[model samples]
Target: MRCPFCGHEETQVKDSRPSEDGAAIRRRRMCPACEGRFTTFERVQLRELTILKRSGRRTPFDRDKLARSISIAIRKRPIEPERVERMISAIVRQLESMGETELPSSTIGELVMKHLKQLDDVAYVRYASVYRDFRETQDFARFLGEEGLNEVLARER
Candidate 1:
């Protein structure tokens, strides 16, 4: 690593620690010539996973977009932020483990919906409504029927 102070290439790592992310390494370094200490972080770069959209377009994977969508579906709910973060991590892990560089948008949606179902029923319904693009209450009814939640909704209704 080049020293920012003197632009020297001679630097040594003084300390190394694992970052909170556990996927990254944090190092405290010193430029031997300038005696300046600095911190550096290193993380593994994964193969880029592209999301093939239903619009027939392709885009790079975006975690922020996923998080935002989940938050929207979970709005006004009692779900915690940590749980959402954990869910995102779990989804990413599944995608990565598949070792596919390109995946359909529907795959991502299904992964989100699967995990959401385990978290909260209302949140699951909310996510499904937006994700499945339900145009009418009947669409929700149909989804519940398909997912076998129809019997429960019927009892409540």
Candidate 2:
């Protein structure tokens, strides 16, 4: 690595140790020319994630927005906030680990639906109503259709 202080192209690593977080390596270096020393952090490059929206627009991936949406779904519910955060993080990690730079928004929505479905039915329906845009009674009916007909009918009665 180039010496930050001496502007020299060569530097010797005087000491190397693992960072406390273990996410990166902490390296102490000495410049041969100016004898000025400096420290550097090194980490592997992660691939950038791209989101292909339904509107045909491509955007950089964002975790905060996903968390916001999930939080909104579970707002005032019995579910724990940290649980929602963990679900969002799990979904993001799954997508990032796929080794793909680009992903469809539908894929993200499906992940959220699958996770929220497992967490709470109210949250799942809340998220689905916003994402799927149930415009009419029929639309909601069809969405509810995906659930077990016997269970829903039993709930009604």
Each prediction's Cα lDDT score? 0.85, 0.82
lDDT of predicted model 1? 0.85
- Off-target runs (Cα >4 Å) in candidate 2 are 1-45, 149-157
Q: Pairing residues by index, what is the TM-score of model 2?
A: 0.66
Error of 2 at 118 (Å): 0.4
Worst 10 residues of 1 by lDDT: 148-157
Best by TM-score: 1
Residue lDDT tens for model 1, 1-157:
9999999988999999986646558899999998999999775547788999999999999877998999988898888876877788778878878889999999999999999988867778889998889999899878888899866556644
Question: RMSD of each candidate?
Answer: 6.2, 9.1
Question: For every model in order, what is the number of clashing pairs?
Answer: 0, 0
